[model samples]
Target: MFELSRRNFLSQGAAGVSTAMLTSLTRGDAPVSEKKYAVVDEVAFRGQTRRLKLMQGDRYMAALIFPTDYPTHFRLKPELYPVCTPSGVPVTDTHQYCFIHHQSIMTGHGKVHVDGTDHAVDFYRQLPYPNTERIDKFHKTHNLFQMGPSGIQKIVKADWKVTDQIQLRLILDWQLRDKESSGGKSVISEQRRYKLFQRGPYTIIDQFTQLSPHSQSLTLKADRHSLMGVRVNDLIDPDDGGMMHDSEKRKNPDGNYWDISGNRKAPRWIDCTGRIGNQTAGIALFSHPNNTRNEFYSRGWGLMILSPTLGHDVRVTKDKPLQFAARFVAHDGALAGKTADELSDEFAAVDYRKMFETEK
Candidate 1:
């Protein structure tokens, strides 16, 4: 286990920033000070996607992409692309064909129900199958909704606030195809927020998802893929040369459902690490203690998901929305189990769902 002290982490950042500042001076440009550097910078919001750059000083850390198109894009969701380590090695792969739905760092759910309706909607697996790159057929008609097997999450509104930390809030309508017409019905109103900050040598992403029924009550049925997911780069996949570690210390070599249990006990955090170029980099996902069902689906093929609705049914009422929170750590080296535990403790101390109450 690699134990990294707080002092060592700051020294590492200082060393890198010194070199970058020197390079800027050589180029005859005004050097950017560490204090004035923006962590999250909006790159572009056009066409079918809204992209943001996660940065450290002048270097690129990651790209957060939110798909604006609905049924047109097979997987209509937000994800982090090319998540790089501090040394500039990409630690996440968003273009893995075999698991096209496995986005770099995204959120998803499956087996959703709208009160008394028999509508079985899935937003996890996605359309046109997982392995194929062929696009799912889109209706060219003027109908507002494109009927398909996948549930669509259209961003009704998106707003961001950049303080010491960056907060991106999205108001989405979880729409499902209406079996009666060519249109779709909005079953749920979702408020998703991503609060990002820098901690030590890690870029910490805090995600909070609140789902309320549009009109009727909602039921999130038991599903293997319910909430947050992290798809590591191919180089870090265990099949290539990576490793996975969880709070429970359970080993899953075949990507099976070993951690999915009838009981409520589950791992608090999971880390996936491997060599990216010459540096060891990885991501750690931590589940909030307040979550009702915090199960995980970890795979050796570079996919790790913290599924909250697995093996249990969750009810979401109008008065009380189904709210859950998670934390993702993107760091340059293999995160230690002790460090994961400490981070998980810190995560549990805060109620991240409180931030979701206000619409900034």
Candidate 2:
């Protein structure tokens, strides 16, 4: 059987794992038969809620938490929480008083136009009109925090498959709140998928998102908050000695990351590396070249986002949906720029269609 040692895995990184796997398949060699990791359901908080945990051997590596508590779960969005390094230190955070809506890793849109309507919906904030405007301008870091939004993501159907990777497939209804009626209106149908696998010293998370109008046409307006987002641990935030780097070789040393170089050019990847206790860990968010390619939202305050519709409006119909994919490489150290580029190139070369095609 093919076996990879921890030392070799750490030395070569995830790219080497791909090469090894492909070589093993090509040479008809024995596979890595040992099941080193697994995805399982975990009950927590006195069994009030359940979550999906990615377990490496007997340790926790990551989790998909469905928040059911007050306020945070009001938005009805599940969060990827407690993303940990190989050594078992969490690199992600959630439910911070500063930004209660923020998740370790999440997805949402700010301004969504249904059937080309004049009013834009703020799914990102999940807040209604006036509240959304109020919260946008309110920046007192120490003041009382309010529930950002009320828009709900209703899970219509969900399925999970485990192979070399653990994949979670969800069909969700993006709904808007109605004052007179309950359960909101389903405006958009979303197909969101997450695949988690181990690649050498990195825990790779590949996200695939597809959105279509429920029954009418929909337009995703160019809003700053629309797309996939991640929030690193506060201890790793740039404000707290962490470092943010992008494909343009720009680093955020001063709290101001509005350089817009990578955002405007749509860099292949952006990352943040920092020390937690005695371990140095990092997370690199990679954009596929085949994506719509728009501005990236990078912040020094522990937030990184991929915005595909930030520059222009994207229209979608029931038949024609808007789709995109991204890869999150969470490793136990800073990744070199060359390695980041290589990983980005490898992700760009993936046959996403075949990998995510509807199984027959």
**Most lDDT-accurate candidate:** 2
Candidate 1 local lDDT, 1-360, one digit each (tens):
999775355335544543553466588754322433254545342454456776656666567776643445445667878665554556677748676778888877777777777555777656422234443354554221322366667777877776666677789887764445454688788888887766556777888888888998878888776778888877667777788877877544334343455332367888888764346778888889787667777778888887667677888898888888888887767788898899999989987667665554
Q: 216 in model 1: Cα distance from truth in Å?
A: 1.7
lDDT of each: 0.69, 0.70
Whole-structure CA lDDT of model 1: 0.69
TM-score of 1: 0.78
Model 1 clashing residue pairs (backbone): none
Query: How displaced is residue 227 in candidate 2, in Å?
Result: 0.3
lDDT of 1 at 251: 48
Q: Model 2 misses residue 339 by how many Å?
A: 1.4
Q: Estimate, for each residue in 134-248, the C-alpha lDDT of model 2 and write its tens digit.
A: 4434566621124433566666676788777778888888887666656777888888888887766677888888888888898888866768878887767788788988888
Runs in model 2 deviating more than 4 A are: 1-35, 43-48, 67-75, 116-118, 126-149, 253-264, 354-357
Q: Tell me how far the alpha carbon of residue 155 in candidate 1 is from the true structure, in angstroms, after superposition.
A: 1.7
Point out where model 1 deviates above 4 Å: 1-46, 69-74, 128-148, 177-183, 251-265, 358-360
